[model samples]
Every structure is written in structure tokens, then in C-alpha cells.
Target: MTQNRRWRRVLIALFVVVIAFTGYHAVRTVSDAIYWNAHRDEPIERWMTIGYVAHSYHVPPHVLHQALNLPPMPDRRPLGRIARESGRSMNQIEAKLKYAIVHARPPYPAPGPPPRPFMPSPSSSSPAK
Candidate 1:
């Protein structure tokens, strides 16, 4: 009986570990899918809008997307109206065409090294590194 209990405990621990791993990778996998989509056949205007909105709000790209309400507005709708409705700032509005909303995939970084893996070391990140 003790042996059975021990094995069961181990099995439970293993299952929990697997679940944690899946949760972590699932986030990365979904993000990577978006990153790839942005790079694949996406127009220059769409890419520029993300950078413009993100910088204007002083927020990360993901937050900017969330702020704008993802999946984008219909092409026919004006960006200015959407921005005003969403309570976004003028700089962000200027970043996008007069009033156009694009799809939600994150923008691809211009010619540069691929996104570096997250490092726990503070010095390894930022200019301080």
C-alpha cells in the first residue's frame, strides 16, 4: 500500500509539472504564431501603425493591441473615430492612417537580430548590461 501511494504521488507531481510546462510554452507558441503572421505578407502600413501606436502610448505592443481592441476595426471605419471612441491619444491616431485599423498580429522588428531569449540576469538586459 505504501509503494502504491508513493507511485501515485509521483504521478501527480509529474502531471502538475507537465501542466506547468504546457502553460508556459502555450503562451510562447501563440505569440510566435502572431509574430510569424505579422512578418508574412503583411503590409508596411500595418507594421508602421503598431510601432506608432505603441510608442505614442508609451506602452508595450501587446498592451497597445489590447488597448485598441484586438481583431481590428473594419476597413471602412475611420481610425480617428475608433481612436476617439477608444479614448486613445492623438499621437497614436497619427501613427495609423487617417482612420484605418489593421489586424492584431504583433509587428515584426525591422532588420535586426531575432528577439533574444529572456534572461534572468538584470545586467544581461538593457544598456546597463
Candidate 2:
């Protein structure tokens, strides 16, 4: 009977720990969502990576890379690093990224077949003969 009581206590403790852990993550997720939503339209910064900028501004990373003349890939390097490597000023890189974001076009899905025009049947159009 003591062993059974001890096992119940252990299970209760385990359950409490799990609940606390999940609650912490849930709170963190909500806070992050709020922060990102608030800053979604913030201007680009030199310290930000291309991926971050793309995510914040809803622009494609490939478009930003093309604007900067970088090869197409998942480049995680920060804008400051890219500027240093390319021998360009941070301002120049920022300008290019901003331009790309402004001019970036949303990718459209492939075209589907055109809808057929509606036509009434001859009998209906002419009414009862």
C-alpha cells in the first residue's frame, strides 16, 4: 500500500512537470507570434540575414539573391557579412534588398483552362412552339 501511494505521487509529479513544460512553450509561442506580427513591416537592417528579411517582408529569398547578384541558394549569411565579402558598402546592400522587396512579384500558379461561356438551350430560348 505504501509502494502504491509512492507511485501515485511520482506520477502526479511527472504530470505536473509535463504541464509546466508545455505551458512555458505555449506562452513563448504566443509572445513570438505577437512580436513578429508587430514588426512584420519594419525596415530592413544590415544585421538581418536574407532569409529573415524575406520572411518579414513576404518576399522570396531567391528574388533578394538575384537582386544582390548572389547565386540561388539558401544563403543564411547576414547582410553585413555579404557586404564585406562583396566589397560593397552596407548601405548599397540594404538598398538592393529594399528595391528587390518593393519590386518582387508574387508567384502565380500555372494557368488552368478557361471557363466556358454560359449558353441557354435553343428550346428554352425560343419558348414552347
Candidate 3:
């Protein structure tokens, strides 16, 4: 019957659409995976916390803050903000900080003993013999 043919055509069209949608997503997913594999070692550009970057580089947060020339603070902020405030691109800031850490100077010499407090000698209090 004509109604049966119409239903069959509709079903076929719907099947084709579903298959296309699924195939498109599958291709996109594969492409993304390939790109990630190729650039796994590259630095990411999205906003990231200073803590994350320092951790990734195996450097302490305070050390990274000092290396970046950022003012002392209790906690880290987003890298994008840091880069903007410093008038540099996010990538450039990250690169410079990474490079500085890799080539940083050796640690400063150990601190010396604390100075002793002044104490008046027993003989000095009175007249020496």
C-alpha cells in the first residue's frame, strides 16, 4: 500500500540521519585524539592557576612568584591575569618563567649563627683588678 511505502521511506531517512550524525562525531573525536598525541609536550594556552604551572614544572609556588617578579602574596592567581598585569602574553610569561627556572642561580650560602646578646661581664660592672 502507499501508506506502507511512505512509512518505509521515512524510516530509511531517519536511519541515514542517525548514521551521519554518529559518523561526524566519530571523525571529530579521532581528529582531536591525534592532535593531542602530536602536541602532548607543548604548553597549553588556556587559563591556569600559578600553582598548577609551578607544580607541573616541579618548582615551588613562592619560587615561581619570585621568578616571575610578581609581588609577594599568600596564594597564586590565574596565569592570564598575571600575564596581563605584566603586559605580556600568557604564553610568553609561561615561557620566560620556565626558562628562568631552568637556568636559575644556585641557592644562597647558608645563614651564619645568630649574634649573641650583649652581656656585661662581672668584672666590668665593678673596677677590674
> Which candidate order results from sorting by TM-score in descending order?
2, 3, 1
Give one digit per residue, the lDDT tens place, for model 3 in 1-129: 999999999999999999999999999999988875664224634476766666555566677678778765754567788778778887787777777656554566899999999999897799757
Residue 92 Cα positional deviation in candidate 3, in Å, after optimal superposition? 7.2
Assess candidate 1 and give its TM-score to the true structure.
0.29
RMSD of each: 15.9, 6.0, 20.6
TM for every model, in the order presented, reads 0.29, 0.77, 0.45
Give the clashing pairs for model 2.
none
Clash tally, candidates in order: 1, 0, 0
Model 3 clash number: 0
lDDT against the true structure, each candidate: 0.57, 0.89, 0.73
lDDT of 2 by residue, 8-110 (tens): 9999999999999999999999999998888685777778898998888888889999999999899888898999999999999988888888889566779
User: Which of the two candidates, 2 or 3, achieves a greater lDDT against the reference?
Assistant: 2
Model 2: residues with Cα > 4 Å off, grouped in runs: 105-129
lDDT: worst 10-residue window of model 1: 96-105
